[model samples]
Target: MGRRDIDESDFHSRPTKRGSRPRTKQRPEHSDAVTGLVTGVDRGRYTLLVKDPDDGGGDGASGEKIVTAMKARELTRTRVVVGDRVDVVGDVSGGEGSLARIVRIQERTSTLRRTADDTDPYERIVVANADQLVIVTALAQPEPRTGMIDRCVVAAYDAGMSVLLCLTKADLASPDELRALYEPLGVEVVVTQRAPSDDETDGANSAGQTAGGMILVPESVEEVRERLRGLVSVLVGHSGVGKSTLINALVPAAKRATGVVNDVTGRGRHTSTSAVALALPVAVTEGSPTDTFDGWVIDTPGVRSFGLAHVEVSHLLRAFDDLDEVAQECPRGCTHLADAPDCALDDWIEASPEDERPARAARLTSFRRLLASRTGSDA
Candidate 1:
């Protein structure tokens, strides 16, 4: 059969002009989008916990659903992290194979950030909208590094979030030294002792030496829960600090993999690779369950170091209210370090009552230590 005359118009030799229509800057408002809490992120997919709008104000199992989502093209340059409150559209039903699109990220109330090290200039946002920063450290085995804890506290303070020092493995070592180190800063410290397992025996009643010759009674997971019941707390620490173990204990269903400290290196194996937010279960009191607690815990992967290259030394003062007040009296640009000429901190410490002089000195020392850490100097 003779081939039909080719219609040149149907087959263009050159590519047609794409995007022929003018684009408008106006974007969809997505007014119907529902607000969701980012629970996890893996690759390009996000896991969001969205509450049912029709369920009234109650937060029951049926009132909430987990929806898998991905960022929309409009937000390609915006980074999304766990604990972010995002607005999602498209398929929001928590069903198999259903995927939603994140249209907008709500303005973050707080952001926990860090850098690769003190010298790195790029800031890495660790978590968004977290109200509390839990600095977990092991009392023994891997041993606690005050340097990392200081860096974490600085980051938290810079982010304007409250700090909580979670000292783990109290049975292995005493938390006294560490507690004394942070006490002057007014940081809330919670020491935890893992109960003896079936093969272990309770030793010396798990009592440990603390500051001022006082004994510290280690708290259990329940006590930790009480501290975190109503806040969004992020757990951060180097490996072997028991962050994953603590998460498992707090939310039994989390089942986060726990790692042990390497006998030779004394470093913990990186078990959790990414950050995830887990909802705390309702507390059981007096043989009854209550639903008032709506706290969430974000378990982050263990890190060898929490860099603070992005933190400003001046911002660290705000964390110490007492020191900040005295610092105001110093000359402009006063670093408040001991060597700053005519630094008001020195005069303030001297003028302090004799009984309060020791505490004032310690606080000044602690503040300087953090400032020095920013510039890679030893206190």
Candidate 2:
């Protein structure tokens, strides 16, 4: 689809009463008050959970204010994300359970995105302001597949978001053995069980330091609250990865719906067909501050495919930021490693000063090895 006819200047400020002195004009106050998070989005319509006026914590943003079914036509942008913080107007009460209109959307920090494919130009933003991408995997009825995890890593790295590998249903499999595969990569790998106890050394860092990071919660809602206390995490994986199960477990009545994994194909049917955000049970854990306030788990539709088109070659390089010194050696305007010719970075290492030459060579060698693994070229 082409860009919607949202005039880029629609949100732009016009000539003010104070000429040459530019300032954003406030909207009419009669418009419904309060900001809200886009709880659910579908068919160009969004359901908003507006925060209470006095609740400034931003955390503990209870759904005291509910506005539902805002249309896309009224919105400035055609697309709406599940976790987006938006400005709403009119009938904010959602009227005897009727919907409200989302007048404006606040700026988003980072957008979780993907392209249709290498040939596709349109950028699809999955969820905006997502702090973490939790790639959930299970080890019981459905086996763990690292390919799915790798794709999630690529997406997370592309968005500059941290990635967490969560292995669920650990009792069914040796969770420790499974976690060992990813722990070496320096990525945070969490092992969760159906039964979480203070007795068992709980490794999940429920310490709420930032927003938009992911945590793996077992079948317990208390565990979800404890682990995902104050972050905006998007749980993604193949169908039957226990994502919806985890969401339903986290938020008491989230009602995301769960499907049974096929004993043959080892995949579950799509239960939650679209990305939807729900208020997590913040009051579950009594002692830990993880049960403090506002947090949401964006349970997205299961993925059958994940392509890297939305990511650029620059993304791959930045993932290994420790080796940027070698990156500068590539010829200017050179196609890094794929589908090109004579763009040698080795020449830079060979020409460097004596003392710096060895370090450059080492970094360049390491960079090349990594680059070769990704691009399948020894350039």
Candidate 3:
């Protein structure tokens, strides 16, 4: 038969009536996967906290086990960041040297992002699932930069997180100026100062003292703690704004290093190199035997600038709910900029009663400033 002529079909096996075995294209259910909160990320490894099976003991006491994990091959393109709730598989015992795999990242309630600069198109996720953004600023030393604060506020509004202006170094300068600036935007402000201490005057000898003899337990500390009690807050600020110091105060066990501002340059050295989600100490009343975990505080590296290259003008406008309503009456395709012809925001502000105009104008100005930041244009 070969010598005569071999047709292509002659050399092949006869096809079955049912044809080749059908491939189901089914995926693994990952039924055994456990959920964990990502507390830290370094290199390619993730540090997660998984609740212990017996966490809620009879006394309602809860505990967590820390596990180290790496992203699964299937999630290579997914970015797992601090504060992300992820599904993990493999050995989740959190035993020494035991490794796990992150198979999935739970949907984030909010994501804070910023570009490297105004011109950079790539947006970097600052943190995930944060409910509040605490913009830490110093009243003196490095000096508060309204520009930076404004940019961070815009980022917070864009991410749908509440904004808190945390003013540090109040003893160095009054927070009235910065407070006045952000007050119109309805951002809550908290002013904190390192309580004066005799040991602080001892200078270098006080190195062993915590945070340079800055009293961690004080009224201002308690106030800040109260605000953080039930929210997942992310602290962001420029270098040397006393952010790490404040974190250490709220979470005594955090031990985040503190740095001093350079007398000449007025900039503090960056002590925190990465973002870490630290668990706040359980608040205990003097007579109460039970304690409660306040919430998580995510500490991020200081940023010199917060760019909004990835943010759109419409997103900024939408963040101002009141202004968004007025903007609805704007002419078709109105940019909403100050120069936009027949923009409704201007008419809205002009029509407001004198008592309400100041606030209305301030919000409009802030919204326009954020829009300008995106394009490097004047507000």
Residues 1-379, candidate 2: write the lDDT tens digits. 8887877677966676776666557555535456878878877677777666655644534335667757435455567788888877666765676666666678988788876554567888889888888888887768887655666676787787877777777667887764655554446776565543343221223321111233334333354455565778888887877776566545544655666789888887887788887666565332544334566678889887666666766776787664455557666876555343544555665668999887666555444443444343554
Q: What lDDT does the true structure give each of the candidates?
A: 0.81, 0.65, 0.82
Candidate 1, run of 10 with poorest lDDT: 202-211
In model 1, what is the error at residue 236, expressed in angstroms?
0.6
How do the residues 228-282 of candidate 1 rate in per-residue lDDT, one tens digit apiece? 9788999999887777777765665576776677999999899899999988765
Q: What TM-score do all the candidates reach, one by one? A: 0.88, 0.69, 0.87
Deviation in angstroms for 24 in model 1?
1.5
Candidate 3 residues lying further than 4 Å off, grouped into runs, are 1-26, 57-61, 199-210, 282-291
Best by TM-score: 1
Clashes (backbone N, CA, C under 3 Å), per candidate, total 0, 8, 0
lDDT of 3 by residue, 1-379 (tens): 4667778867878678599777677757788999899989999999998877867531112577889999998789888999999999999999999999999899999999999887887889999999999999988888788888888988898899999999987877888877767887879999888765555521222211245666533567678888997789999999998888788767655778888889989888998999999876555223433235668899999888898887777887777789888989998999888889999999998899999988889878867776766667777
- Candidate 2 residues lying further than 4 Å off, grouped into runs, are 1-33, 54-63, 72-77, 175-181, 194-227, 283-294, 330-379
Extract clashing residue pairs from model 3: none
Ranking by TM-score: 1, 3, 2
Alpha carbon deviation, residue 103, candidate 2 (Å): 2.3
